[model samples]
Every structure is written in structure tokens, then in C-alpha cells.
Target chain A: MAHTPFERIWDRHVVKDYGDGRSLVFIDRHFLQEATSGRAFDRLRAENLPVRRPDLTVGTIDHSISTLPGRTLHSFAAGVARNVAMHKNCADFGVRLFSIDSPHHGIVHVAGPNLGFAIPGSTYVCGDSHTASCGGVGAWAWGIGTSEVMQVLATQSLILRKPRTMRATFNGRLSKGVYAKDMILALIGRYGIEAGVGHTVQYAGPAISALSVEGRMTVANMSIEFGARGGLVGADDTTFEYLHGRELAPKGAEWDRAVADWRRLYDLGDAMFDREIEIDCSTLGPQVSWGTTPQDVIGVNETIPDPSSIADPTRKAMTERAIDYVGLTPGTPIAGTPIDVAFIGSCTNGRLSDLEAAAAIAKGRKVAPHVKALVVPGAAHVKAAAEAAGLDKIFIEAGFEWREAGCSMCVAAGGDIVPPGQRSMSTSNRNFEGRQGPGSRTHLASPAMVAAAAIAGCIADVRTMMH
Target chain B: MEKFTVLTGVAAPIAMPNISTDLIAPSHFPGKKPEEAIVMSFKDKLFANLRYFPDGTPKPDFVLDSPRYQGARILLTGENFGCGSSRETAVWSLQEAGIACVIAPSFGDIFHDNSFQNGFLPLRVPADDIDRLTKGLARTNASELTVDLEKRELRVSGMAPIAFDLPDNRRIPLMEGLDQLRFMLRSADDIAAYENRASTERPWSFAAAGG
Candidate 1:
């Protein structure tokens, strides 16, 4: 029987079905970070079980490790003990770990794909919401809670209820300075935050086909923000090109065989979807979240929505509360909103291309005198590559701090938070109230948008600086 | 994990949508090591943003602060409660604060899974039922509500009981208090056979770490 790409992959991994909707799905790779894995590991020990497939599980310290250059684990303010616990637990369980000192250590989602652990037509699970980033390679990856993490560690499988499929096709061409971030933000802005609830979103169409693997990762990474189960972009020449010769990717004659199989993972023309959305990307501009949620977004040229004009009472209340917390006036243009900081990092936008794009804008320019700006690479290798390409030098000369790799400033748990009452233009995913700090307001945008905002000390359209 | 067949307690209502984990347990320790902090610190941080003023004094208008809802073991919240972040601390903080069950129209995926693993019931009922329960508990001035998982009904004073459905796989665990990992391990042979087949079919996945 013909099946969608998602069903083919999901069906291939199902170990056993319990007669209900639930099935024990095989996990190809299990990635772990310090913050979420400690409890799962502890629970495994409490049950007197070892990591069932230690060879397939890899641990790293991303969430609880400091991104300060030349910093040690002991220097991590809040995550020191947790980082220590991770090392101890991983060591005891014989799970391979990329420590803070390891050059490969970074965000689990970034490290997984960067190291080629995320193979096409496979499944990856992490106790992280951004695990969908691996879907850029046509893998079906999603986040699990600590308990599911424990279950996977104990049995190398997960009991999952199949989610309905939703196809979101982005057609036409993206405008100059618009990006995958803009594409997703615009989609979320049009469709409310809960648009993808109970569904796995398949991204296709001409616009998605044009995206680089890194860009696809950026789009897939934010699936959780809009409440999607996960997001997938099918593998093609671009996918294989990105995976070829990567550290953990297939090699030798096996590479040819792997490519042949991955080629068949594309969706059939008549693939069915429970729901579908077709987006025209031609008119989309640089999207920035105006309020707390990702759905509360507007184009760079647009104004904040007035609560009174909003039709939904719940959404209106949310808008009012967001305006109050963000200290923004309703109906005012968002472009000139003053910002105290600019951040370009996170699993979403911290890839090498993100750094290169931001650096291109930063070259021969300076950050606003009063504004603090930072550039944290998504992975240690990305930082090293940026340094080799002199992107780090460009950022530093522009007064943006080029830091080491980790999930810095994204989760705001590593002491990289913006000050209270200060506003920030960030390339990270979430913008919930106080997500960055106690009273810090976050405006989400692309790397170039963040760079432009840093230079202007206010939210600015990346298109204005594109040329 | 405590076996939960039934629970009776006052249900504090917070009818705000997208009540994220950050709000449930504000991630604001500010250089304080979480591993070093006392258990009470997590309890103190529960609902800190809405429950307290900037000076750390309890807010008078907060639902959890009301004397009538003191010791509430069930929470009646709006849609998408426990969204944002994969922090298990959100569930831990609520559990520490004596919330044994969360009744909502829906929940964030990870939070729903985390709640069950932590022995907390995250019951999903129809939106109308949730609204009716919230209004009924208020109108009747009912201090106690009963969640009968075995009967799949929520009983309150002077109101018709509302039925809720829990999938059998999840329901069985709650009734037996079985650890999910141990339960999963029961299918070890099937898992092994599947992996053996998968590795043969897709050997790239089992290649050496970073090759």
C-alpha cells in the first residue's frame, strides 16, 4: 500500500502494537543533555536497569553548561552541580558523552545532525522540545519527557500514539532578506499557535525545496512553538549533499545504498494528509513576534495589533497582557521599538549560515553604542568554522560578543539573560513573557534581522540593510 | 509513583490560556544552583510570578492565595496549560505545591506526559465540561471535588458528574502505579527483534559515533 513519507518511516520503526493506537516504536538515536537527562538517568537506576542500548545513546551538556569562552564546568553559576551529575551518570551508564571540554559539545539538536547521528529514514528522541530539528534530513524526530527518556534508555523504544499528518506547503519565492525563520513565523502568525496540535507537519512545495538543510532545520526546529507534534522535510540531493562525508554519516559503498533508500522516502504525488495549508511566500517579509507568543507576530513593516480590534476574547486578553508586559502601545509601528540587546543563537538560528549572514551585515559596521549584542554559534564546530572564516572577527570588531557554543541565551538558564525591563531582538525561538529574563521583552526575528536591530538599537527590517 | 484511582480535593481555578511552565515555576533563581537549593525552594517558586508581588509577598488576588482554596490538590486551568519548555521542574513544583491532578481542556504534549510519569493526573475533558466544572465549583461554593478515575467521572456538589476518558495504556499505569520504563522493558524481545531488522536495513544509523 502507498503511504506518506511519514507513515513509511513510522511504520518501519514500529516494534509492536498493543492493539490500541499505541505502539512501541524503535528509536535509532537517543540524545541527552544535562538539564533533562539527570532525572531520567536517576529513574533508570532506581529501577535497576542500565541503558539498554548505550551504543546508540549519546549525552552532551548543552542546557546546563555555560557558553562563556574559556569557561569551565565549575564556573557555570546555576548548572555546575547539574553538569557534574550528568558526567557522573553518563560515565556510570557507559553512554558516550561530549563534555563541556569536548570540541563537539553543543546543543543536542545541533550536535546530533552536525555529527551525522541523525540519519535519514530514522527516529531520534531527546528530552528536548527542539528535537524536530533533525527532521531536516527526513528523519522522524520528536521530543519526549524525562519518563519517556527513561523508557527509551531502558528498552530502546517508545510507546507512541500515532499523530495525524498535516502538510504545509510553502509555494512561490521568498523575498530578499526573508528567511526560513520568516517563513515559519509568518505561518504561525497566520495560523494561530495551536494550528499544529495533534499533528505532524510535513513541509513541502517549491519554497521548502529551495531551502538549505540548515535553513530547513531552522524551520523544523520551531514546530513545537506552534504546538506541532514535529516537522519533516523530505530528503533530496540537498539532504544527501549535506550528509555526505559528515562524521557519523554513511560512507564507502554503504553511502550509495543509503542514498538510494533515502531517495525513496519522498512523498508520493497522491499522499494523503489529514489537514493541509498552502502558503504563498512571495509577499512574506521579515517576521517578528510583537507579543508574547509566536503567533502574536507581524511583518517588519506592520504595526502591533490593538486588543480592541482582535475578535477572539481569549486572544484579545492575551494581546492586552502581552502589550502590558512588553511595554508596547497598541497599533504602534514595531520597527522603531527600542531594544537594549540583540541575540543571534539557539538551535533554531545558530548554524554556520546564520553566523555568516549576521557577519555579512556586521562587517564594516558597529553595534549601537548602548546596545549589547552577542553571537553564540549553535555548535562548537560551528564556532570553530566561523573563527576560521573570520566571521568571529567581524562580529567582535562590530562589538558583538562571539561566545562559545551551547544553548546560551535561548533558554536563558545559563546566565546569558537580558536585564530586567530591557527589550531584546533575538533570533531564538520562544518569546514568552520573561522567557529571557524576569522582565525582559523578546522580539523574535532572523539572524539578519537581529543584526540590523543591533546596529539600529531598535527593531529594523533586514530588507533595508540587505543591499 | 502512587496509584491514583480516585482523588478528592478543592480545585483552584486559573482560567488563563497558554499558562506556560515558566509561569507555573518561574525559572528565576539568578545564579542560585538548582541542585543545591532546598526542596522548599522549588515549592516556593511554584506560581511565584502570579502568586507574589515583586517584593515576594503573596498577592491578594491570586487564586492560590485565596484562603478558601488552601490545600487544593486539583487545578482547573484553561487550554494549553503547561506549554513552553521541557522543564520537568514545572510538574515537580506543582506536585510539591500539593497539586495532585490538573483538569484542562488540553495540555502541552510534554507536560501531559510528565504529569503522568510524576503520578499526577492530567485529565482532558471537553471545553464545555471544563467551563461547567469551573463555574459549577464556584457557583456551588464547593470546597471539594472528586475525580473518580475508575468510574471515569468527576463528582461535584449539586452538579451532574462529567465523564472523562483516559486511554487504556495510560489508564492501566495510573491504576497500577507501574513505572513506565519497567512497563516498556516487558517488550524487550520485540524491541530487540525490531532493532536487529532496522540495523540490517539501515546500517547508517548504527555506524560508529561521529564515524
Candidate 2:
């Protein structure tokens, strides 16, 4: 049968089909974090359910853990009890947890791939939405709620309704200073946020193939922002090269056999998607969200869109509200909009390559005096590697605060937050109202764009600074 | 879980698009207990940023805060409601605020799944139907709406009942207040058999952690 990669992976994992669009799909890997896992663990204890496959499940403390240097579990007082609970729960359940002191400790999405746990052609489930980041390596991955988390914990499976398939082909090559972030932001901006709802998006074509695995992770990480449960690129030599010798990846003969099998995991020649969209990346610019929604985005040089010009009343109203929330004038260009903060990390853009790109821009320039710029690595290993390569020196010398790894201000649950009414240029995925903090306004951009903004003290084009 | 067969209550209109889970339940609660932060007691924080000012005073202009919409049990809003983030806390907040159902043209995929797991109904109707309901509420003196899950129809004052579509699999669980975990446990034997086959078929998937 000619099938898409999604259908191929999904067909292999069906444990039982209820014949009503619901199937008990076996999960290959499960990643858990503190914020959403506490309740799931508590429920498991209440029901006296044992973790079916403890070896396949891994836990970490990222969501609420403070990214402060020399930090302990007690550093963030509010997060302390949750971190404690995670440790206790993982210990009691025989699940391996990367605690605060573990070098493996980091954001679940980042650590999963770094540790080689997100194997190609396998099924991955996590409690956090960005678990789709694993799909960068060609895994079938998606996020689940705490109740679904309990389902995975007790049985190593989930009762999932098969989602329709959509293919987003990014044709042509991205111009210089444009990146995977811009490619994805441009797609969401062009297609509206709900375009991928009820579907798993497969990112293909020349531009997607050009992206490094880390860059593809940045693209896949934001799939949820567009209402897609999962997004992925098919495995190729690039993917195999990235996963070849990682910590938990299959070794020697197993590796050869796994690669041989993964090579056959792509869509068949006659495969057809339920929906298809093509994005020409050659003309795409470094995109920045001018308003609250990711869909309310414009190129760095573009002006804010006026709501009155919109034809659809609902979209017009949404534009008006977004503009009001973001405090932007309709005719003003997005480039010169002053920012009070610059954040350069999240599961979206917090990787070694992301750091390298930001460092290239921050090499000799100082951050603007009015801006408080921060660079939080996605994982401890990423932090260690960056420091080893002197990327930390480039950032610190540029007046950016180089911090430990975790989901810092991307989600303000860890007490790291942008203040009320302050505008920030961020590399994180979402720009929803109060997403960074209550009344905090955010402009989503690429890591290079954020670094350029930090230097210029506003949302500026990275190409201008590249030279 | 509470079984919801029929819910008849005041329906409030929030016409804004993309009412994100972050707006429904803000993430900036300081000094909250871990369990409290994760699962329960978020009624006051429901739409905290939109419903109240930074001074902790209610925003009277907000529909949820207005006197007419007090104790509203149904929310009629724009498309893509509960978009962004896979936080189940958003569902908990709406449930705590006495909202039994949310009628929208569309929803965030994760939020939709989360709603069903909690036995909360997330109704999807055509955009035209939403417009008719929005207009019907504006022209009428009464704003009460009746959602009959068993019959798959929505009844509003002075308007013909609108038929809705919900998959039987989702509807039956919510109506029966069935726990999904117990239901999944029944397939343990099937899962075990599948695992036995998968062990040889995909050995790399079960590679020991930290290998």
C-alpha cells in the first residue's frame, strides 16, 4: 500500500483498534517533566498502577526549574516542592530521572534527542506540547494532557484518534539570514494558525532538507502553535548522521539494521496527503510576530497591518485586539519597535546551532544599554558544549547574561519573567497574550534576529548586522 | 468525572479569536503549592488577566465579569479557542469557573483532546451557526442555552434547535463518566501480545536507557 510516513509509523504501533477511529497505539519512548507529571504520578499512586515500561520512560525537571547559575532544586522556592515531587515519583516508580545535578538534565525535548532517546521511525509521547521537536529526527511524536499522560504511564500506550495528514512542502532555498524559524513563522502567518488543526503536518521539499536536525527541531517545536499535534520531516542521511553515535542510539549491527529500516520509512511515490501547501522559502524573510498570535506576523521590514483593511470581520476583530494588546501602531514598521528585553532560548531555538548563530551576531557588539538580554541553553550538555567552544565568552562579552539550561522565560513558571507592559524580542515559540508573563508583550523571532534586536535595542533585521 | 448529559445555563459571548489557554489560565502564580498549581483551585485565576486588572479588581467591561453574565455556564466564542500550549490547567480553569461547554468554530487539537478527557464538552459548529447564535443572543432578552449531549442538539431562546456532531466514542465516555484508564486496562492482553512481536521487529526502540 502506498502510504505517507505518518501512516506507516502509525500502522506499526496499533496494539488494538476499537474501529471507531480510536486505537491503542504503543509508545516507544515517554518523556515526563515536573509541571504536568505531578498529577499523573499522583493518580497512578491512587490507582496503584505500576509503570508498564520503566526503561522506556525518562523524567526531567525543566518546566519550573530555575535556570540560575549554581542553582539547586531549592533555588526557585515555588518550584522546589514540584521538583521534590518529581524526584520522589520517579524514584518510587523506577523511572530514570535526570535531576538538577545530572548533566543530562535539560528541557525534555532537547534532552530526548541529545540523549538519542528519540529514535527514528518510533513513537514518542511527552506531557509537554513541544514533544513534536522529536519529530525533527523523524519520530512520530506528539504531546498529551495529564490524563493521557496517566494512560501512557500505566500501559505504555494511548487511545489516540488517528489525525488526518497534511504536507507542507517548503520549496526553494532560504536566503541568507533567513532560517527554519522564519520558514515556519512565515507558513503560520500565511496559512493562519488553525490551518493544521486535526492533522499531522509533514514538512518536506528542498528548504526542509537544507535544514540541520536542530533547525528542523525549531520548525517542528512550533507545530502546536499552528494547532497541529505533530510535525515531522522524513529520515534521510542527515538524520542518520545526527543520530549515529548518540548516547542511547542503537549501536554497531543494530545501528546498521535500524538505519536500513528507517531508510524505508519515507512516503511512497503514490502517497497522497489529505491537505497540501507549498511555501517558497526563497522569498521569505526573517519573520517576527508583531501581535499576540503567531499568525499575526510580518517580515522584519514589513509594517504592522491595519485591522480595517482586513476583509473578514472575525480576523479584523482579532487583528484589532492583537494590535491593542501588543501596543503597536498600524503603519509603523516592525523593525524599529523598541524592545525592553531580548530572550534567546526555548525548546524552539535553544540548541548548539542556535547558540552559534546568535554568537555570530554578538561577536563584538555590545547589547544596547536599555535592553536586558539573556541566553539560556536548552540543555546542560548544550551549555557545556557552548562554554567549551567559547560561545559563552562571545555572549557574556556582548553583555548578555549566559545562564544555565532550562525553559526559562519562555514560560514564566520558574520566576524568570518579562515585566508587565514591557516588550521583548524572544526566540520562544508562542506569543499569546501574557505568555511570557501577565501583561508581558512578546515578539517572536529567530535567534539571530533576537541577537540583532539586543544589539540595536529593538526588533532589527539580522542581515543588516551580518555584514 | 462528572457525567454531562444536558446542561442548560446562561451563555456568554467572547467574540475574540484565538482565546489561548494562556489567557484562560495564566502561568504566573507565585507561591502556589505544587499540587494546587497542577490540578485544582484555579477559579479565581480563570481568565485572570482578562477578567481582572493588575490591582486585583475585576474588569467590569469583560464579558465574564459583567453582571449580566455572572455564573454563565456556556461560552460562545470565535474560532481557535484554547489554542497554544498543551496545558490541561486551561480545561481545569474553565471547569472551575462553572463552564460546562465551549462552543467554537474550531479549537486547538490538544485542548480539544484534553476537554474530552476531563468530561468537558468542546462543541464545534459551523461559523455561520456561530454567527446565528451570536446574533440570536443579541436580539433576545434571554441568553440561556441548552446543550443536549444525548440528542446532539443545542437549544437557544427564540431560535430553532441547532444540530451538532460529536463522535460516539467521545460522547459515550463523557455521558457515562467513564474513566479512560480503566477502559484501557482491559486491553492489557492485546498490548502484551503486540509488545512480544515488537520486541524482535524493532529492538532499537526498546534499547536500554543511557546506552
Which candidate comes out best when scored by DockQ? 2
TM-score of chain A of each: 0.98, 0.99
TM-score of each: 0.97, 0.97
Taken in order, the candidates have interface RMSDs of: 2.4, 2.6
Model 1 CA lDDT for position A9? 85
Q: Total clashing residue pairs per candidate? A: 0, 0
How many residue pairs clash in model 2?
A: 0
lDDT by residue for model 1 (A192-256), tens: 77888788899998999999999999999988887885889999999989989887788989899
- Where model 2 places Cα greater than 4 Å from the true spot, the runs are B29-40, B139-142
* Candidate 2 lDDT over residue span A293-378, tens digit each: 88878899999998888998777888888899889999888888899999999999999999999999999999999999999999
lDDT value, residue A348 of candidate 2: 95
lDDT tens string, model 1, B100-141? 999888888778878888788889887789888888888866
